[model samples]
Target: MANRPKKLPKALQKLSKPRVDHIPGLVIAAPASNSGKTVVTLGILRALANGDIAIAAAKAGPDYIDPAFQHAASRRRCINLDPWAMTQDAIRDLARWHIGASAGALPDGQSDGQSDGRFVLCEGVMGLFDGAAGGGGSSADLAAMMDWPVVLVVDVRGQAASAAAIIQGFANFRPDVRIAGVILNRVGSPRHRDMIMEACARAVPDIPIIGAVMRSNDLALPERHLGLVQAGEHPELEVFLERAGAIMARDIDLDALLGLVRTQGTDHGRVAGTNGNDGTNDTDGDHGRDHLPEAGSQVQDQAVAPKDDGAAVSRYVERFAQNNANYAAPVTIAPLGQHIAVARDDAFAFCYPHLIAGWQAAGAKISLFSPLANEAPPQGCDAVYLPGGYPELHGAVLAAADCFLDGLRDAARRNLPVYGECGGYMVLGDCLVDGDGISHKMAGLLPLETSFHQRRLHLGYRLVDIRQQCPLGNVGAVLRGHEFHYASTIRADGEGWLNARTADNRDLGPCGLQKGSVFGSFFHLIC
Candidate 1:
């Protein structure tokens, strides 16, 4: 971290400076999944931003999707703070840096100058107490480590006064983790809200009711198999956010909630053990992966391809550009090459921001291309990285993307370092079967075939020991990552790449394959 650049690139200058000693922040968590925490988090972020409060958003664990929506709501880059995959120092460093980069001297790093007055709003993954099978990485873990208060978003759809039991359980779950407040979501009626409010007063009177969100089908975001069909794919996303913000601002006590934020503390960072796991296999399933960069005109020229709907493509490109503008200040990791072409777009969008920013910090130039747009890896890139995304949904489109497929094959022929993960890995294989049971020809760089139709949930935290020299690192270099995808391998050939295991130290034997310079697996790296 000492080698990290003192100044961020010109592109990142837009983030307002943060208060070094006191940037107010809180962790917005819930009792369980579908408690409407994402909606509530987005609403609060948008509402606060609307009221002229500069906001910084973060997601707990290794999720890459929700942060994109969080960024959209806050009009800022949203970073993932993973308790499981990163060290305690790494977690605190990332959080401090993200609160505002210009704030001076963090515990582990230094930034120059004044405060931007940004309030960080971090959304929790799944349930608050949920973490990996070994028990470490959870929203509660993050809240405790940061010494910040948690605002529980409890879904009160079916029960009213009984919601007090759920609130009391979470409040007393961990002594170190404080449940400062609660937001009752999906309230049925005035009576419903009042009943829950009265019960909480008699039970957990120390904890206050932050808000009671009225039930509304309109507030719900659309979802497909993976989760909410990505914030990027949503039509009228801005309208949705605007409406949600207005509702939250009207219903919630923003000032009271703000009071719960730990505004003035430098010693809040307390050390915990480095090893953590994202709670449960289903935790990753709910949160999704790959928060994309803010889209901007910089990508339009090279990233967007010719589609049948020209006007639609233009709008999509413009929206995509909004999220692609800034890259985070780098945290160090070894660069694969001097220049790397990374795949992005709806098809291959699971690349981590830290990985990209780290590459840039390590002095590697990154060029992005869209396989969904029929684009190839940019010329002159010494290496290519294909990240995980929803390739199965667009199998036919990718099969028809001749330029993209041909360019990938050409890169492999040149013996360039080419790596893929999950969806990207599926594309590099000989063939892929979509959910409709239609098999399409792929890049054919690896002697493998996969099927999204014949799905099987292959998930959980992975401790990969690379058995061969590849893009990640030297042989025997251990990496902590995770595998969360439904694409089953139909056929696989070639030598094994990684000797992997679960978080609890169970052997998974050989994972993924390597042939020449091209290799991939379903594993997604996180650090």
Candidate 2:
């Protein structure tokens, strides 16, 4: 017997009229950083979700923070789509997975573009055209890959009519990329809004004025050195999202914006894009150098080994365009153990959702605990993962957590895999000096000392080869990830774990450290 289709609730049915059997979506972009695109993206996501519309969100590039806020706004898991670090197929697969996961499994013949009335909203990173130093991984690349129209969020604070020139230039910049609309942010007054709108209409009449957002303090989110404060730490987050949504609902053209979204044709309209060039002149046309480890070394493989077939380390080489190879194809790194304990709190909140999702997909169970709340990792867990976050801000409190510190040491003694990244890595050290120059005792599992007082920015995409066997991977296993931290290593004494180089081939030498079953680095794995 054929089963009948389940009907939506009355509220959802009322909101589902305009969706024409397609999972409509658009990329919210900006001319430059701090152009109010993040706020606009959050506002739109919350507004649509509030209207009983199913929403899925993603962020272009390797950003762990923005996706957290996007997830909070849309009430669904948000994934990072990094054109620099991830292949086009992986990006599309992630998008499809996110949509299907959010809106329940798609019907037998349905495609990503034909969802159950769910809308996918992607927030662009940095400037629309800005990418890695060598090129590729820009917001423009993601938009072109997805065949979605871009809605530019122009910050109109310092300029009025001149804003149209920027819009016109971008509209004609790339013949392959489409500019569908504009959202005027930080409009001074009615006269200022009128002037910008009139200029845009006269200059780039094809690009519609999607919205004119007035200047307001309500939409701004607090920030720390790394990025915006974690969504979990925001006390009035609900109120802030509601107010932002209300403002977007009042000012933005919700219906017109939806109209600009592209409906996919089974292949998700992927054929139109996928040239794999992210607008950079790099040799790979993807991003920085992809260094496969040196060949002819073998070691015992563990749960944390690369999930794909075992391959000897191949020497680092520049990929030319002859074969048009995608060196950044996503690699699934196996989980550390069957049951992994992850620390989660305001101080330890920089974990990536996709990494966790990948772990679960590989048949691993994740148990979360809070060090800031004086909680320890769950008992009987085989491994512990401490993610990067603002541990420097709460150094005193973390130092006071006796249970958390003791449990971490106990894990180290038990030879359980205990891994950390950046902030997490700092906590596993002997001592951490805060921004105020005060030293706090930390878990003495590793012979490392770091200081926030003498901060130095260490930020970029990293191509790393495992230097020694650790829980992360076997020796000579190559991996791709990112590193962004302000803490400086004050003192260290241990064997190097990873031999890393920046995306552009700048040698970073050996990084992080390893001792017994404990190992970590400043870099956060992306794949």
- lDDT (Cα atoms) of all candidates against the true structure: 0.71, 0.72
Off by over 4 Å in 1: 1-24, 102-117, 262-332
lDDT of 2 by residue, 1-527 (tens): 12212332222121111222223456899999999999999998888777666666889988878988887887777878888877777776566555555233333322343222244588998999998866778999988876667889999998987999999999889876777678888888767877877787578755667578889988899997888988987899999999888888777756445544421222322221111111221112110111111111111221111222111100000011111121221335778898999999888888877777778877789999999999888998999999998899999999999999999999989999999998999999999999999999999888999999998998888889998887667889988888998999999897678989888778889989888999888989887
For all predicted structures, in order, the TM-scores are 0.81, 0.80
lDDT of 1 at 416: 91
In candidate 2, position 301 carries an lDDT of 21
Model 2 TM-score is 0.80
Count of residue pairs whose backbone atoms collide, per candidate: 18, 2
Shift of residue 123 alpha carbon in model 1, Å: 0.7
